[model samples]
Target: MTTIPVTDLLGSLRSGNSTAPRLTWYGPDSERVELSGRVLDNWVAKTSNLLQDELDAEPGMRLRLALPAHWKALVWALAGWQVGLETVLDGGPADFLATDDPAGAVEQHDAVIAVALPALAMRWTGELPAGCFDYAADVRSHGDVFMPHSDPDPSACAVRTQEGRIIRHRELISGFALPHTEGARLHIPADKGLESALANALGAWQQDGSVVLTHPDVALTGKLLADERIHGS
Candidate 1:
């Protein structure tokens, strides 16, 4: 039996040695979910194809997404990771300009070759700093196949936190502990499995991405997840 590090899972596929797929996200419907299944040899194979067809052809090879802190953005984020690209998660149009310099700060830390922001943010009627692309319509022009230019490298995942500076995959993996409950390991999207209350709780807790605290007086478990804003504050 071999133990695998979750952080290295993406890297394994890029190396063309691993075939097992991992479900990185659930869906809004809870049932109609988005998962990174091993439908091919690896994720990089799919990402590479998509990059070559759509993303790479776009104005900038780099992208910044200004979307809500919902699962859709998470899907986009993971896609960016698969292609070894940089992502700037913005809180939408309201914070667009205010975030522009902050976003530039992120780009300064790394060379942001292209931009991948949501349509709403790009067309917020505010002045764009120049050279920004509309990801919504542009992405549709490309096919769904993900073709990576290179293999997945664990060291490649670079994300910007609100606190300041950059954080890499290596640093991210060592910082957290997995929850012991079954619910903490698997995450069921909010609308999914509503009938299966226990299952929903199990999924949420298993993922360890959510914080489900209890209100003894209310006798209910409150769940929290990472979104555009901080979770479990």
Candidate 2:
């Protein structure tokens, strides 16, 4: 019997032992977009290549940027960790509203940063400033392979603020833990209007070593079952 920690997911990704399914991205217009696994793989590959190519000079650092509700945003963020780069998500558009222009926004931050602007904003800011990388194009390049400079610490992540970026240096998810063993089955108890019970059960299951799977809507048991795709039985 083997118990696996939540952190193992990151390791499995780095070792090429696993890949994540497409995370659905919901946009502001009530539109949903699904990015393919191949796109994620390529972005990760490109990021790895870029990290190796730039290590002697830039040595990638934590990222800071605002992203639209696009699936590519997830790819970019994950790609950062894939190459041992830290990533900070934008607080929100209100923070961006403070700036008079993109250049001003770029100058306000101390470190090299990449931003994903709204379609209108991207058109307004014709080209990226020198030394700044276009986050989207860089992640999309197909030929590059990401060779990490160091093993990514699962705890390494960042948060954005109007003032600047703060490194959390810890895994971001809170409130629940997911644990697993190779050949056992487990269930996330129906919410039953008991959030605490679900949390406690999840914690105990994680503690006792059980694979956990969940979905956004607890009513849809069929969807939840389909998504669990792993459980190596």
Q: 86-144 in candidate 1: lDDT tens per residue?
A: 44432211111112223343333222223332323333344333444333334444544
Give all candidates' CA lDDT scores: 0.35, 0.39
* Runs with alpha carbons beyond 4 Å of true place in candidate 2: 1-21, 26-32, 51-60, 89-101, 108-125, 142-144, 153-233
lDDT of 2 at 77: 45
Residue 65 of model 2: what lDDT?
37
Evaluated at residue 150, the lDDT of candidate 1 is 51
For candidate 1, the TM-score is 0.41
lDDT of 2 by residue, 125-170 (tens): 4665555555444434435454444555544443333345443434
Clashing pairs in 2: 48-146, 48-147, 49-145, 49-146, 155-170
Using lDDT as the measure, which candidate wins? 2
